[model samples]
Target: MNTTSKSKADTIAKLREKILLMQGFKPAGAMHKRITGLMPVEQAFPNQVFPLGAVHEMISEGPEGAAACGGFLGGLLGTLMADAGICLWISNSRSLFPPALELFGASPHRIIFADLQREKDVLWATEEALKCEGLAAVVTELNNITFAQSRRLQLVVEKSHVTAFIWRKDPVYLSNTTAVARWKIAPAPSISEPGLPGVGFPHWQVELLKVRNGIPGSWEVTWSEGRFHTHDETVRKLVSVRNDVQKTG
Candidate 1:
């Protein structure tokens, strides 16, 4: 074959490989399916539970609280994506802290942060990003969002099979809605030794205020070194002290 013909054939082959990856046409079936049967929660979601490929909404009272919630959720989503997919962050007010996020298994490089000015623009851009077949998940921050807009986002996520996370500045009062899960995160107790302490940030208290197919109510979670885990009573006391310091400071 001539040089030009050979080059053309190679290019075509690369294109075909790219197409296959986008379609998830692997030689073997999905690994998740094989192990999911052993997990009850995974069965409940049917569409991949927790932060995997499911639409979730997180609402916080203020920017500081929202940062904690966002970082924790980002890590969860990042851990789910691992090296196989990318996480999109569409923010209007705050920027994602790379070092903090990296602790949760999100690679700073894999995160794509986009700053948008208007609420409508943020929603529009988020919708477009969710439609991308290549992304593992998309997370967006919006100061205001309506039920109708949320429903539209849900439709796009369902169609594309991409997980969407919406973070709002304040609580959204939707009597009836289509969100798969709704979470409210707050500053909880810190996990630290009471007497043997250096200066560090406070931990978090996460509550699953609403979940479509899962149990809801309070869930105590602590954050440290970019990782989130369940908080025990001992850690809870530490967090209480930390909370006091924060309040006084």
Candidate 2:
């Protein structure tokens, strides 16, 4: 064979090897399917496949703020489901506002809100949500979570091929856990037209505090008109305080 032909064959062989490795590295018990495309994050930052078997920690400051974060994450998960799937929201503090969730593109009917009275119950329900294959994703609001509990939840999500979203009231140090990513969500000032008067409802600033296999940094995201989009520089600068908290805390 010619040298050029032999080199082409070698490249093809290497590509096949990489594909095989990816297939094997996928979390066990996950059923592989042909996903058509990913949801849109922004023109600059495209949406990515939701990592299976790994906990995705989304920390927000309060109940209202957590709901905003949960809504965005939940909508992303909802877009991935082939059919309308159950979205389990496990919380001990407050029930999510349906109207606010609608702003994030989540259908109220697809969501199941479970209000627990204690932390133990919240964790137990979160585990159950992770185990349920019928669910597309599970969003949990809690004050505290231990590494051991996170590990258990991760295993369940892997086995069930479900996404687990933990919305914490405050930031907590996580060590010895298999979380793929950790995010801090905060409210950002709304954008306004040059001639327009009066302030508008605020947007959100999403900072990826930690990502196992992706870029980690601040991304200004806003939920408006039933969609999530990246923010402009002015909006991002206005929300510098939230970014500072995520960076320093």
Best by lDDT: 1
Alpha carbon deviation, residue 183, candidate 2 (Å): 0.6
Model 2: how far is 145 from its true place, Å? Answer: 1.2
Cα lDDT tens digits, model 2, 1-249, are: 699999999999777657634532343234532222222222112124445445778778766676657666755654544366678888888656666655555677778889889999999999987888888778888767888888888778767878788877765654545667787777666555444667655466777777654567776566555445566566556557545754897
The list of candidate 1 runs beyond 4 A from truth reads 1-48, 172-176, 199-202, 224-227, 232-249
Q: TM-score of every model?
A: 0.70, 0.71
Displacement of the residue 31 alpha carbon in candidate 1, Å: 5.6
Query: Could you give the C-alpha RMSD of every candidate to the true structure, in order shown?
Result: 13.8, 6.8
- Give lDDT: candidate 2, residue 19: 67
Among the numbered candidates, top TM-score falls to 2
CA error at residue 70 for candidate 2, angstroms: 4.0
Question: Candidate 1's residue-wise lDDT over 143-221, tens digit each?
Answer: 6677788888877876787878888667556444567767777875345555667744445666666766456656566
